[model samples]
Target: MKLKFLGKRISGILAILPERELHFDDEIGNFNFSSSNSLKLKKIMGYGRHRLADDDTCISDLCIFGLKYLFDAHLLDKAEIDALVVVTQTPDYLIPPTSNIIQGKLGLKHDLLCLDINQGCAGYLVGLIEAFLLLGNEAFNKIVLLNADVLSRKVSKQDRNSYPLIGDAASITIIERDSVERGIFANLQTDGSRGEALSIPAGGMRMPASDSTAVLELDGDNLRSKNHLKMDGGAVFNFMQTEVPPMIEDLLNYAKAGKDDVDYFLFHQPNKFMLQKLTNKIGVSPEKLPSNIVENFGNASSVTIPLNITFNLGQKLKDQSYAVCLAGFGSGLTWSSMFLRMGELDFCKIVEFVNKGD
Candidate 1:
């Protein structure tokens, strides 16, 4: 799908990362690989420390904490918010949407719209798209788009493929009308035929969680249960390399933009290797496309895009505007990209999630 939106711009961004940092070396022995092989994987995949929410922390916790920070800073006014949109693969519950949970916890107005979108990897782009759409309604003025995931809690600690790179994070983005009337161009594609390329096989309705699903069995070279995140690494890599560059080309063409017109390509961070390869195929310089998020903070699912911005370009974004391209691809076999003028925000920073009373 191709989408175009006008008169909508993001005013602020706040990314909250878990305080708990687990280093790759500390957990190297947990993987089923020789030390030399594990070290090789780390060097190749850009494995470093990843943030994982403590057992007690939930998706709602991060969102509430980040939202309150904005509220307290006066960067955002609760009363001015017309909608709350949360995009996450990990919800606090199967019922009572996390958006509603956040609104109620903060005691926001009843007239506001609260919606939850189930998406992954491409979530930041997905969330922005949904936020833009919601702004089309005359009733909505300000929308808070929250992209969060605590998928470390979903993956098996014994699984070498995903454990070292899984991270937890939440981003609070404030989007509202732009007086300048700039156009935001975007495109989204999904291939459910290859959905299993990245999925958790036994958590939802089709196959409810059970003892059988929880049994650890050998999956390739790793031991993982059906309840854990399952990824066909090779398949996903091939899919991204084959699909993303063309999708980005189409998006740039649709927006009548040349590659040089973009100041930065803020893409989802799956790993350092994949991003560099994608950047090569896209014919952009490595400096224009950052791939260090995995090495610094691991891949926090959809939050990676916002996390990338806040972590790498927060200072610049706070005072200057830039023409940027954003892309996120993963789970759902989904790939999405957006071209927009973003920056000059009220706030753009990352805060560590500190527990209350700690």
Candidate 2:
């Protein structure tokens, strides 16, 4: 899908991360990799450490915490929010959407618009698009777009290929129709035939959880079951390289912008090595590209994009302006890229989680 929307601006972004963190060294007992090999993987995969929620925590907990912080900080008011949209694969429940739950928890007006979208990785771009469309409605002035995922709970600790790379995070982005005429130029692509490249195959209505799905067995040197997250690393890497570069080039052309015009290229940090390769292919300088979110935060799914904003551009966003090109690719075999100018944020920061959610 190729599209564009005008009059949408990002007022602020707040990303919340769990307090409990896991380091690569801690995975020795969970995986079969040798010490030397584990160190090599850590450097190549950009696995410095990743924050994870406690066993009882859910994606909503982090999101609600961040949203409340934003509200309390006076960066935004819950009363002014006319719409709430949450994009997550791991909702609090299988029935009532997390967005609906959030609306009730926040005590927003009952007439508010609440929607939950199930997407991964590309969800940030998808949410931005949704926000812009909702802003078109005069009745809906302020919109909160939330993107989060707790994929750590979906993977087996024994699966080194997927476990160490997954992290948990949530972000609250306030979007409103701005006076500036600047808009978003975006292109989205997907290939469901390759959905198995990254997926959790069970626990959905299509394949309800059963004893067979719960049976953990050897997958190469690692162990996983239908319920655990799975990824064909090689296939996902190939997909990224094959589909991403051209998409970026086309997006730049669509917006009539050059590499030099973009101040920062904030992309989904799948890993450092892959992003370095993609940056080289795109001919964008390393200074203009930040690919190290996975180094400290791991891959927090769609939350990775906003996580990048708060981590890398937090200070810049406070007093400067920037034109950014954001991209996300992975689960759902989905890929998306957007060209937009954003800065002068009312708020931009991250908060560490505590026991409040419990």
Candidate 3:
């Protein structure tokens, strides 16, 4: 799908990360592989340390904490939020939408709109698209887009494929209508046939979580239960190499712009190696695409894009405007990209989620 939005912009962004940090070396013994092979994997994948929320923390907790920080700082006003949009695969509960939970907890206005979208890696772009669409209504002005995930609890610690690099994070992006009449162009594609490449086999209504579903079993070289995150790394990598470059080309062509025209490519940080390969395939400079999120903060699903911006270009983006391309691909077999003029934020920063007691 091709999309174009005018007179909408992101005014600010905030990423909230857990205070607890875990190093790759510390978790080597948790994997079945030898120390030598584990070290090799770390070196190749750029594994360092990642933040994980504590056992009791949920996505709502992270969002609420971040929102409170903004509110307390006077960067955001409660009455000004026209809508609350949360994009996550790890909602606090299956029945009650997490957006509503956040709104209720924060005592936000009853007239505000609350929506929850079940999406992963490409969630930031998805959330932004929805936010921009919401601003089309003349009555709406400011929208809060929260992209988060707490998948550390869903993945098996014994599973080397995902555990060491799993991080939990939430990003709050403030979007509002702009009078400047700027254009935001984007494209999205999905292949449901390939959805199983990255999914948790059991959890939803089709297969409820049971004792049998929670039994850890050998999945090739790793151990994980049906409730754990299952990833066909090779399939996903191949999909990215094959599908993303063309998508970027199509989007650029549709927008009548070339790759060089984009000042930065803020993409999802699955890991360093995969991002490097995609950058090469897309014919862009490595410096333009940042891949350090996984090493420093892990892959926070849809939150990676916003986290990347706040981590890598926070200070620069606060006052400067740039033509940027944002892309995310994974989980749901979805790939989406957007090109827009962004920056001059009211604020951009990351805050540690301090525990209530600590």
Q: Tell me the tens digit of each residue's lDDT in model 2 across 1-358.
A: 8888887899998899999888878777678778788888888878788888898888778888888788787888888989899999899999899998888887888878999988899999989888888888899899999998888899899998877778899999999988878868999998999999998899999999899999998988999999988889899999999999999999999999998999999999888889999999999899888887887888999999999999999978979879999999988888999999889999888999775645
What lDDT does candidate 3 reach at residue 38? 89
Candidate 1 differs from the real structure by a C-alpha RMSD in angstroms, to one decimal, of 1.0
Q: In model 3, which range of ten residues has the least summed lDDT? A: 349-358
TM-score of model number 3: 0.98
| Winner by lDDT between candidate 3 and candidate 1 | 1
Cα lDDT for residue 230, candidate 3 = 95
lDDT of 2: 0.89
- Order of candidate numbers by lDDT, starting with the best: 1, 3, 2
Tens digits of per-residue lDDT, candidate 1, 97-198, equal 999999999999999999999999998998999999988989989999999999999899999999999999999999999998899999999988999999
Model 2 clashing-pair count: 0
Tens digits of per-residue lDDT for model 3 on 1-358? Answer: 9999998999999999999999998999999999999899897887899999999999999999999999999999999999999999999998799999999999999999999999999889889999999998987999999999999999999999889878899999999988899889999888999999999999998999999999999987799999999999999999998998998999899889998899999999888889889989898888888888999999989989999999999989988988999999999999999999989999988999988942
In order, what lDDT does every prediction score? 0.93, 0.89, 0.92
Sorting all predicted structures by TM-score, with the top scorer first, yields: 1, 3, 2
lDDT of 3 at 55: 91
Pick the lDDT winner.
1
User: Candidate 1: where is the Cα deviation over 4 Å?
Assistant: none
